[model samples]
Every structure is written in C-alpha cells, then in structure tokens.
Target: IGASAILAENAAILSSGGGDTIDLGFDLNLESPINPATVTDVSEDAIEGLKVVLAASEEAAAAAEASMPQELVDHLDELSVVALKNATNLITTSDDEVDIPPKPEVVPTIATITAPQQEQQSPQTLNADEVSLAPVAFDVDLSESSVKEKTLDEQTPSVRKILKFAIPAIGVWLCGPILSLIDTSAVGVLSGTVQQAALNPAVAVTDYAALLIAFLYTGTTNMVASAQQTDRGTKDMPRTAKMMIGAMRMSTYVGAGLGAFLFVFARPLLRGIIGNDAIGPAVFAAALKYVRIRALGMPAAAVLGSTQAACLGMQDIKSPLYVLGAAAIINFLGDMLFVGHSNPLIGGTAGAAWATVISQYAALAFFIRWLSDKATKTTNEDQPGVINLSDAILEMTSKSDKKDCNGKNRRQSFRNVMDTFKGKALDAKRKRSTLFQNKGVVQNIRESSFGKAIRRRKETTTKSSTDDDDSFSTRGFLKNRFTTRDLFKLPDAETREKFAPYVLPVTSTQVGRVSGYVAMAHVVASSLGTVSMAAQQVIVSIFYCLCPIADSLSLTAQSFVPAIAEKESSMEKSAAMKKMLVNFLKAGAIFGGAMMAAVCGIPMITGFFTPDQAVKELVNSVVPLLLVFFGVHGFVCGTEGMLLGQKDLGFLGKMYAAFFAAVPYIMLGVKRKALAGCKSAGLSSVWTVFIGYQLARCGLWLGRAAKLQRGTYIAAKEQESAAASATTNMSALLAP
Candidate 1:
C-alpha cells in the first residue's frame, strides 16, 4: 500500500507543469493497538487503519499546497485531479482489468540559473539565448602527479650511493685544475700579452708532456686497486710490492728521459708547432726558457704522479693530498719570492717555471720518504725483531740460583745484566773466573746504589717479559726497516709480461686526448692568427679547468665500478653501471648549468684574465657554445671513466683513435671555410667542430656502455641457466 501511494505521488509530480512541491506522509500510530485474538477483530482493525492512513495523507498534501507558490500549487492540484479521474474511470470501466495511458517522455530544464542579483525596483530575468548551454570543464593541476616522482627520486638508494663516491672524487680531482688556475692567475699579472700568451702554449706543451706518461698513474691505480680488492689480506704483498717497484722504475726512467728530450728540443718544438708568428718572437723566446726550466722538473713530476697513483689505488688519498698540499704551498712561496719582484736569481716566466720545478722535486722527495715509511711499517709488523736486553734480563732474574741475597750471587747477576745490556753472551766458565778473581770488586758492586737499581730494573723487565708474548712492546726492539730498494724492487719477468698488455692501451688513450688538444691548437693558430689563438687557449684553459670536476666524477665511477663488479652479480653490476651513468649525467647537467651561468658572466671573467678588448669580446661571444661543449664534454669524460673501470681498454683505445682521426677532417673544413672568406669561419667554427666532437664522443661512449651492460646481463642469464641444468642432471643421477 505504501509503495502504491509513493508511485501515485511521483506520477502527479511529473505531470505537473512546473514548480511542484513533494509531500511524504507516514500514518504509524503509537497508542492504538490491533488485537489478533479472532479473524473478525483483525478485519475490523485493518479497515480502521486504512481510513486513518487516507486522512493523514490528505492533510499532508493540503499542508504542502499551502506552503508552495500559487502557480506550483495550481499545477499540483490539476495533476492530482487528473490522476484521480483516471483512476476512477479505470475502476468503473473494468472489474477485472484496467486500461492505462502511456507515460509522457519527461525532459528536465533548469532555467534562468543566473548569478544572484541585488534588490532593485525591477527584477531582472535572464534570456535563454544569453545563458550558456554547454557543460563546464575544469583544468587539471599536473603538479599533483609529480609529487610521487619526486618522492621516488629522493628515496632511491642507488643515487645516494653514487653521490657518496662521486662527491669526494670530484673534490680531489678539482685540486689539480684549481692549482693550474692559480698558476694562470700568477702569470696573468705579468706586463704584456706576450708573456701571457706564451704561458698558454708553454703550459700546453708541459701538459702534453705530462699526458705522455699519465698512463703510469692511471695503470698503477687501476691494477693496484684491483689487486688489493682480490688480495684483501696482504697475502699477495710481495706481488703488489714488485708491481709498485716496477711502476716507480718505469715512471722515473720515462720521466728522466722525456725531461732530457724536452729540455733539449723545447725551442725547436715551440717554433715548429706554435710557430714564431703565433707567439711573438719575444714571447716565443720567453716560452722556450720556461719550457726548458719546466722540463728539468719532469722526472720529479713523473715520480710524484706514480706515487700518487699508488696511493690512490690503495684508497689512501690522504697521503697524496698531504703531499700535494705541501707542494702547492712550496710553489706559492717560490712564486712570491722569485716571480713577484722579478728577482735577479730567476726572472719573469722563468721564475714561475723554477718555482714549479722546486715544488716538484720537494714533492718527489716527500713522496719517496712517505712510501719508504709505509713499507717499513708494513715490514716491521710482519717480522718483529726480538728485544735481547729485556729477554736476557728476564732470564737472569728468573734463575733460582740468582735469587739469593749473597754478595757473590748479586755480583754475578749484576755482571750478567750488564753483558745483556751491551748485547753480549756470557759463558759460565768466564763468569766463574770473573767471580773468583774479583771477589773484593763483587762486594763493592753489591753494596753500590747503581747495582741495586740494576737489580730493580731487571725484576721489572722480567715481569713484563712474562706478561707479554713479545717483550719488545715494553722494551724497545731493534729497528728492522725497509729500504727504498725493498719498496721499489723490480717485478719478475712473468709479472711484467702479464702487465705489458695493459700498458699500450692505457698510453694510447691518453695520447689520443693530447693529440686532440694539439690539433685544436693547430686549427686555431692557422685560421685565427696568434691573438685569436691566445684567446682560444685562455677560453680552453678555463673550460678544461672546470671539466675535471666532471672528469673526477667519471674517475670515481672508473675506480669504483671494477671493484664493485668483482664482488657483485652481473645484474648488480649492470644496475651499478646504470646508476653511475645517471649520476654522471646529473653531475654533467649541474656542471653545465654552472658553466652557462659563468658564460653569462664571461665579460666580467675575461676582464680579470686579459685587459685586451678583442680577446675579451671573442671569449664572451663563444661563451654559450663553450657552455654546451663543457656540458657534453663532462658526460664524455664520465663515460670514458666508466669504460675504463670495466677495463675496456681496447674499446677506449679504438674510440680515442677514431676521435683523433676525425679531428683532422674537422680542422680541414675550418681551414677551407676560412680560406673561402667566410666571416663565420673563425672561433665559432672551431667551437662548432668541438661541440660536434663532444656530441659524437658522448653518443659513442653511452652506446658502448649500454651494449656492455646488455652483454653482461645476457651472459649472467646464460650462466644461471647452465648452472640450473647441471644441478638437475646431478640430482637425476643421484636418485635411485
């Protein structure tokens, strides 16, 4: 019955033209009760309940009509009347079945939904044409989605781990460039562009010379670190020692030989490559002097390089840092004293060169001493010497016969202690002869204060000897030191043969890099003239100085990856490489951003280095291109480092060779363009070529690293499958 009433009301409301109000009523009684004692009583109660429900519904409808607007009330009343008439007609027409009309299709129209208006004499109505008919849409905020991405980045363990190594490595690597910058700054204060321009090419020559032997440093670090990882407990100390010795010998010989060659040919080489036109005759002369003086320190520099590499390989960076710090201080002092006032002893650029030479030799001496000390400490701990004095004292005090307080026994004990102190053995027959012959002397010795002190000291020494396994801890042991001979002993023929394969690849990689720089210098000098070449060098120097930060990050990867690879599964190694690449790319991007900022400020920076307007303008104009070059170059360096870590020397050598081979063509193009009278074919052209080179290097290295990673993963999976198959076959064979 309630369901029928609700349907009737809904139908009425739908049929109403507009503004119809809905009224719902309930006719539940709290006080009235219907008894179920008899069927007649239940019938009477049901009839009464129906009447009450009908009356209550009518009253609710009347109340609803009174509260509603006149139009809505009229429409509702008409709807109700129509519904009632239809019901009456249907009931009267058929006793068993009733015909009903089909319901109308109702469409809702929410009209005139205008914004609220203020009270006025004339109320405004919105026109249908003026109202919007289309559905409204809202814009979405994309920032909501990025929150999860940022959280994931923050939480990544691999990124954090990569940073742990990268940060420190970058810092250490930065020290070299920073020192170079200081040198440049000191040179910049000189009188003219001649001296300053000369510094650029001179430094380049010295750097190239250093690069020729840089393999010793890199090779030593990689091999030694790897060896240390494989032999963690010093079991392979002898082999490592031999390798160290061989590296030192190679460094010194190559360094000394190169130094002599450079010292002799400095003038001709500068004239041939840099040319008399590029560097003024006066500048060339000064540069020649600088190069010769600098050449004198090459042996020391090489030795220091090898020592540093060894220290780095052992993960003992502190020692190298200390040595370099001291060297830098010495160089600074020498610069101030010799170069500041143009001292008569050493003047101008030569003074600076002399300062560097002095510092290099000083550093070399310190490194040698430090290495020797390290070796001696290790050797001493390995083979501890016996403390004879303490042992003899302990032996004499422990003898039961010597415990007596008699004058003769005391004198004998004193004599035995003195013999031990003097590092001599006493025979029993000799002791008896001395004791009998010196009876009066024995009485005098027993009563002396020195004799009593000796007995007391012997008792303490004996007690200490019994308490400790090695009495040397309490009493000093003889110094069993390792000499330079032991520290730098040559490796056996087989060991050298094993390491020989690695030497060439490493050297070639460095040579390829040096060749690129040399080519760049040649291109710049030929096309742009000496002034432009000088400007190019200054800009290049700045870029190279900052680049090591990125290179350091790469070096970190190189140093860390191999060690990680040795211990981890192939999957982990792949992940490590990926993580390292991501870290390197991030570091490169950050460095690039900084360089871009520096590029923007290049005008100001150029002022500090050079007062010449043309040079400053040239540098500033190419700053943007240089920024791109540095950004891409950082990743190239990092990728190279990663490959280096994998010990992919052959691939690196080939890539470097390809780079060197391609550079000449680029230079040729620049030269042809310049000859064709193109205004744009100058420094910008050079930078374009450089940028292209950087891009090519980055792409090649990144692709190679990816390929290596994929290969490692595939190899790991194949090995795992093979292991599983072997295990299954063994299990089948073992079953009954």
Candidate 2:
C-alpha cells in the first residue's frame, strides 16, 4: 500500500509535466524508482528528501539543455520523432490488444482434447479439495441388472410356462405309442396277413394288461403329487417315501401275477378271442406265441409304468422321456434285425415280442437307476444307515460286543486278534472295543476322501432325539430303496381308513375303463374279421396319438386341481376352474381341427399301416366318425381330468360302469344295423359305436361338472348369508 501511494503521486506529477517531456521520461525509465523500504515510513523528512532530490535532478537537466547548441538540439529532436514512429509500428505489429485478430469459425483438431489427453494435461499439484472437485468418467455395466430383470420375468407363470409342462408331457406320453405304431407298421410290411392280423389281439391283450395295472400308476401319481403339495411347507419326506415304496411293491406283485396268468393262458386266451373258425391256424399260433413271449415283459412293463406315473406326479416328465427314447431305439433296432427273416432266432412275431420284452427291462433298469439317484440326492439330510442284516443278526445273537470263533462273546486272545483285523482294536484291560477306538487311526481315516464319505454316511445314520427333523436313517433308506419284506402287506389301520373311500372308486374306475376296452376288442375280434380289426387297430393307434393333446391337458389338470382347490378362496377357485375348463376346451378344438385335417389325408396315412386297398377304403370311411369321436372324447377327457382332480372318483366310477354295461348293447346295435348283412362290417360301424360311447361320456361328465360348479356357488352364497345374519343379530343385541 505504501509503495502504491508513492507510485500514484509520481504518476500525477508526470501527468502535469509537458507531453513531450512526459514521453521522453517514459522512454528513459519506463518504471517507478521509489523503493518500498523508503516509502514505508511516509514521514515529513522522507517527503522533503524526495522533493529535494527531484529539484536537484530538474536543475541539472535544465543546465545541460542550455549548454547544448541549436544544431545538436535539432538533430536530437529528429531522432526522437523517428523512434516514436517506430515504437508505434512495433505496438501495432506485436500487441493483440492493439490489433485484434478474428477467431476461426471452426475449432481445430489440436484444440479438441479427448478424456485421456485431458487427464494427461491436467495438473497433478491439486490439493485434496481440488482433486475431489474434479469430474470423473466411467462406463456403467448393465449386464447384471438386465440378467436380474430377465430372471424375474422367467419366475412369473404365463402361457409359456403352461406350454413348457404340457409339451413335454405330450411328447413323453406319445413316444411309447408312436414307437408301437412304428413296430406295427414294420411288422405289417414284413409278415403275411395272418401274422399281421395276429398283432391286433396280441397288442390289445398286452395293452389291456397294462391298463389293468394302471390303477397303481394313476393312484400313486395322484397320492404322491397331492402329498407333495400338502407337505411342501412341512416337508414330511419320510411319509412320501413310504407311499412310493408301497405303491411300487404293490405294482410289482400285481404285474407279476398278471404276467404269470397271461403267460400260462396265452394260447387259450388267443383261441377264445380270435377262435379257430374265424382266423387261420397260423395266425392263432403266431398270436399265442407273441402273447406268451410278451407276457414275460409284463412285470418289467408294470415297474416302468408305475415309475413313469410317479415321475409324472412329481412333475418330472423328462426322465421318462430319456428312458423311453432309449428303449424305443432298442426296440426299433431289434425289429429291423429280428422281423421279416425266415428261421430267425426268435422268428418274426416272437422276435417282435422279444424286442418288446428286452426294451421294457432296459426301461425298468433306467427307471431304477434314476429312482436311486433321486433318493440319494433328496435324502441327504440326516439319512439313516441301510439296515445291515448281518450286523442285526450278530447283535441279536451276542450278549456282549466281543464275538468268539463260534459266534459267542468271549474275552480271549484269538477273539481279540479277529477284532483287531476287523478294525476294532481291544484295550489293554481286555474289554470290548468300538470300531473307531484309536484316535490317531480314526483321524487318519477321516482325513482320507473315502473316510470322509464313510463319516458322512455315519453322521446321516446316527441321530439324536433333538435332531428328529434332520434324521433320515438307514431304516427308511432300506425300506424305500429295496422291496419291502412284506411286499403284500396291507396299509396300516389309519392309512386304510384314510384311503378306503378312494380305493373302491379308483379301482372301479380303472376296472370299468379296462372293461370298455376289452369289450371293444372282443366286439372287433368277434364281430369284425381280422382285416377290420387290423384297420381298427391302425385307426385306434392314430386316435391315441392325437388324443394325448387332450390327455396331457387332463393330466395337467389332475396334477394341479388339488393344489388350486386348496390354495384359492372359493371365488378364486371357481375362477381358476373356469379358466382351466376354457383353456382345455380351446385345446380340444385345436386338436379336433387337426384330426379333421388328418382325416382328409387318411389314404396317405393308412398306407403306412397297410397296402391293401380294401383296408384303406374302410379306414377312409371311418375317418369322419373317428374325427367326431376324437372331438367328443377330448371334452370327455378334460372333464374326466377335472373330476379326478376334484377326487370325484366315485361318480366317475359309477358312470364308467354304466357305460361299460351299455357298451355291449351299443356295439350289438351298430352290428345289427350296419354289419348284419355285410361279410366284413368295415371299421365304420365300430367307430360309430365308439362315437356314441364318447358322446354319452361327454354329456355325463359335462352334467356332473355343471352340477358340482352350481353346488359350490350355492354353498358359498349360503355361507355369506349366514355370516350376514350373525352380524345383524349382534348389532340388534348391542342397540341402546
């Protein structure tokens, strides 16, 4: 501030000076000479000293100027003028402030800095506050966020979800029959008429047998699935395992019994159905051979069927598909190698039977392996040890832990040696030792990989009272994994009482269903000749192939109905049922439309089954009837499924019995009117009877479903009314 004041006074003095002199002074010394130290005091003496120095310098300058001659003065004046002009030029040329240049319209590349260049150019001397103020650039990763969003979408159920279950189930169910169709076609192409015709009854017998045992499959599936849904929260896995084991053992016995019956009575059954007068001796012989050979596979078939049903109940259709696909391949290859060859190892018809038998066993093996794997994985927590029968016997016979050579407990040297060899080292006190006695040895064993597994198994088997929930001991493991000792053991009193109502209905329903098929087959074999039966088989196979669309939906309904009924409120349950019914009806329409399209191309399709023109024409005549049958059957199937889901088996059983009783009459009527005069009735009459049966079935189911729906609505209304009445009574009592 002091130096600034002095400079200001000096600048004021210079401004008062003459213009030319001011210029000359500026040229001589462009800066102020006053020192900051001298100006610091700002006293009177300092000011006076500054004035005296300035006066002296001015006097000296005047004396020197007077001494100068006129010529010298003129020359100096000229030089000064020139220097001023030159200074003006330099200012104009160098100073942008004096002469401003225009900025370029476009920015230059050199002026544009990238993020990397800006970082490089930025000063590194910034303080913490400065650094924090700096802007940062980063790339945001969106993949993880996007994946989470997609996962949430997948977790929500939609049409896509329904199709996911339906499509796989349809494929799994269709694969077996489709394979059989292929086998039939292959056999037809290779064998004579008798051999080909024999396939009809043979297949029918085997199919009938399979269907008869289907109760185990269907029953197991429903029970297990329902149990799973109920125990979803509590996870009572032991009870579920027992149900499966019991069902499986029961299926095995039933299958074995049926198989033995079929095996022993194969010829008699074939003779009874086809009869000697109706068909050639060769056909009957072939049919008998096929039935007998095929019967051997029935046990395996039963096991496979039961396992398949269990898998379906558990919503695990993929396993069955894999198993079936492998079996189909084996059967196809067997058919190619064994059939159509004279003097083949098993002959033509019998070869096909053997192929079926082998494939069935192979399927059973895969199913067993899958079941074992599933059990091992699921029962990981607190699993029990497998009951060691030998150990149990040993424990029962011996009074002490120690055992002698003669299976007696004795504290002896020889016994001790044997115990040590068995990994049970005795103590110096001559006392019996545990299996894991030596700490060092036990530690060593535990450290090994195999020992770790043993330890795990041991941990699973051993249980404490406090750890009951976690316990899955060997007792349960053995019971579930192996055939029960009492394979034919009846359910416990509690279980029998619980399942009694369901048993009769389920049994009756299954029996009635099989009876209808049996009656249809009997009618076809007895009334319609072999050719018509063969055509019927072909058409029926095609019908089944198409029917799965409806059947799969039905199965889906059966699988889910109980869950829906339990979880939803009355209104919500009603809505769900309506939605299910509408969806199934739509699916039926679609399936029926597809069948109609198939009917249009019956000639080409029937060609695959047979080359005979008469058979082809007969198949075509029945195509329209088949179409009607499928359409009506689809609705029946859907309603049946809903009823089954609702556990309305009693009504279904009664309806099936009524239908079964009327089936003979229906067939007889069709025969009397349509087939009485003709030598071969063709398959048209047969399909007509079937269509009538389906129509009646559809009507009964629809009526029952409507009645159930109406009853439910009425009950809900009554409940609401009662609740309202109770509220009114309470309000009246509280009035002041």
Q: Of the candidates shown, which would achieve the greatest TM-score relative to the real structure?
A: 1
Tens-place lDDT digits, model 1, residues 30-118: 12232222112224354456546644555565456445544344444445445444322211124643322222111111111112211
User: Which pairs of residues have clashing backbones in candidate 2?
Assistant: 382-472, 383-472, 384-472, 384-473, 384-474, 385-474
lDDT tens string, model 2, 1-736? 2323324334434443323323323222213342323323445565455556644655565456445543344444545434323222221233322331111011111222244533332222112222111111222233433433333232222333345556677876776576667567668777766677778777777776666665666677777677666544333355556666666666676688889999998876666555336577777778788888888887777767766766666666677778888889888888887777786347678778888888888876666666655343554354322222222222222332465445644323222222232221112112212221354575677689999898787865563222333322222222345542434465455543444566567677766666666666667767676577767777777777877766776666666556554432344345555666666565556655665676667767778777888777777888778768766665777677778877788898797777767876776665665446674554666666677778888888889888877766666567657878999999999998
The regions of model 2 sitting more than 4 angstroms off are 1-162, 189-193, 234-236, 337-345, 374-503, 514-534, 566-569, 672-682, 723-736
Q: Which pairs, if any, clash in model 1?
A: none
**Cα lDDT for residue 689, model 1?**
79
**Top of the candidates by lDDT:** 1
Identify the runs in model 1 with alpha carbons over 4 angstroms from their true place. Answer: 1-158, 170-183, 187-193, 234-242, 276-279, 340-345, 374-495, 567-597
TM-score for each of the candidates: 0.61, 0.60
Clash count of each predicted structure: 0, 6
lDDT of 1: 0.60
Worst 10 residues of 1 by lDDT: 470-479
